[model samples]
Target: MGKVTLITGASRGIGYALALEMHMRGHHVIALARSEDKLQALKAECNDNRMECAVVDLGQPAQVDQFISALVDRGYTISHMINNAGALVNKPFGEISASELRHVYEVNVFSVFELIQKAMSVFADDIHVVNISSMGGFQGAQKFPGLSAYSSSKAAVASLTECLQEEFGEKGWSFNVLCLGAVQTEMLAEAFPGFKAPVNPSEMSTFIADFTEGAQKFIRGKVLPISSTTP
Candidate 1:
């Protein structure tokens, strides 16, 4: 059997492109996202049975755990786990609400932690775990005015990746964080309406696919910042 890759937020943007790229490389992709319609569209685009999808709200940890359990019961061993699902609440720091902050953390930080914990049980030997973060959250990256909640949540993700690497790297698991720069995607557009991102989602996805597929073996537990411009 081909290696199984689990990708969250796979219905669109970088996640969707990564799913396609990985599928083309002959891997079995399990794509999860909140939009059923988009997920179906992605599956249809695959034009093969190699891609599976689930419409899931990653903010709900219990539901995510149940889904992982089902995968385990089905005798699936995941070789790659991509925590690509994230939420952004781009508001001024002063205007951010408690609920908004909670939601962002729930989706970006807590859900990632939960998924990684559950996935650890079924990870194949030498598995790679990629947690998507942002350049804004990365140290010394250009800061934006309205991204406090989202950026902080991503920062937590980076920290978590580092900690998990220390705990799990000795056991053949590679944990890495990709602190991505602005990409031309819905999320980026929503956050910065008039700004044009230097790179496209497909371009970023290709780089990410290469890393997760094998290139990542050269380094473990590293936070990589990728952008067209130096930060």
Candidate 2:
């Protein structure tokens, strides 16, 4: 078996593309998502047994626990993790409900922490962790009108990446955040309908695949923003 990569939200968009790319490059990919049928399709499309998948809603602690239990039972060892799952709510600060804020953070930030805590059991030496964030969360960037909850949740992800790198770097682990700009995907279409994104999911996934494939030593602890303005 090749080095194992654990990728969240792997049923579609950038997550799906990344899973396929990593598998093509000979990594054993553990794809996690809420949609079992979609994940099964991804696995079949790969046409390789190297892709493993689990269906779980990352926002729920109970589901996360079950997923972890299964992972442990299988004795899977992980060399890299892509915390790609996220929840976005596009409500103005005053209009956003408390529950909405909580849900956003639950999936975007807390679930990542829980996954990392659980995956320590199988983490390889010199492990790399990539936390996906958004350029909307970039400190002092031009603020969008209705993204307070989503932006803050992603900001928290960036903060966790920095803190984790400092806490774990000496132990041969690295953590980084990809604070991505607009990418064309279903999520983007839902979040910003009719707005054309310069970068497609496949294009962005190729870049992310390189980072997860061990570009960490050079760029650890960084929150790199990526985008192309081309329409």
Candidate 3:
């Protein structure tokens, strides 16, 4: 059977490309996002039931929890889980409200934790979790403006990925954090204006999707950086 893959933020950008690439690889993909319209368009583009769409907003974990429960009821076991949904904050730290920071964590870090918790409860031993992090989490952590919340949350996510890797991955499962550089996405556009996106979403997605699909072969429990700077 094809590997069952579920990707968050699947409406556009890297997520959309990842969904399409996974379906092309013969994996049964559950493309998730908040916009049902984009999901419909994604479904139309794929034209295969193997590429299904789930309306989920990661910031709302209760809804995602309910959706997971329903999938469990249907005996659907996800082989791969990609935590790709996130929020961006571009204002000064003082200007960024508490609620704004809270929601950033909610979507980027907290919801990932919740999803992993749910996945652990129901998924098989061979399941893999891939957390998509940012170069901002490591490099320019303090250099960028208005990145205090966004970067720190992703840094937390990177830490959580390591923790989860140590806990579950060392035993049997595969858990990884891929710290990606500037990709051609809306998020990148906001982070650094005028600098052209060094990476194409489709190319990035294809590389990362393949990496996610066969994580056990190359990596086990670690935070690896994928950047143009890397040889």
Best by lDDT: 1
Off by over 4 Å in 2: none
Determine the backbone clash count of candidate 3.
Answer: 0
Per-residue lDDT tens digits of candidate 3, residues 32-143? 9999999999999989789889898877767878888987887887888888887888899889998888888888888889888876765757888899988778644334
Q: What ordering of candidates by lDDT runs from best to worst?
A: 1, 2, 3
Candidate number with the higher lDDT (2 or 3): 2
Question: Weakest 10 consecutive residues, lDDT, candidate 1?
Answer: 222-231
lDDT, candidates in the order shown: 0.89, 0.86, 0.83
Candidate 2 lands at a TM-score of: 0.95
lDDT of 1 by residue, 138-194 (tens): 987888889999988989999999999999888889999999988989999878888
C-alpha RMSD of each candidate structure in angstroms: 1.2, 1.6, 2.1
Worst lDDT 10-window in candidate 3: 135-144
Error of 1 at 73 (Å): 1.5
Candidates 1 and 2 compared: the better one by lDDT is 1
> 30-74 in candidate 2: lDDT tens per residue?
999999999999999878779988898887788888887887898
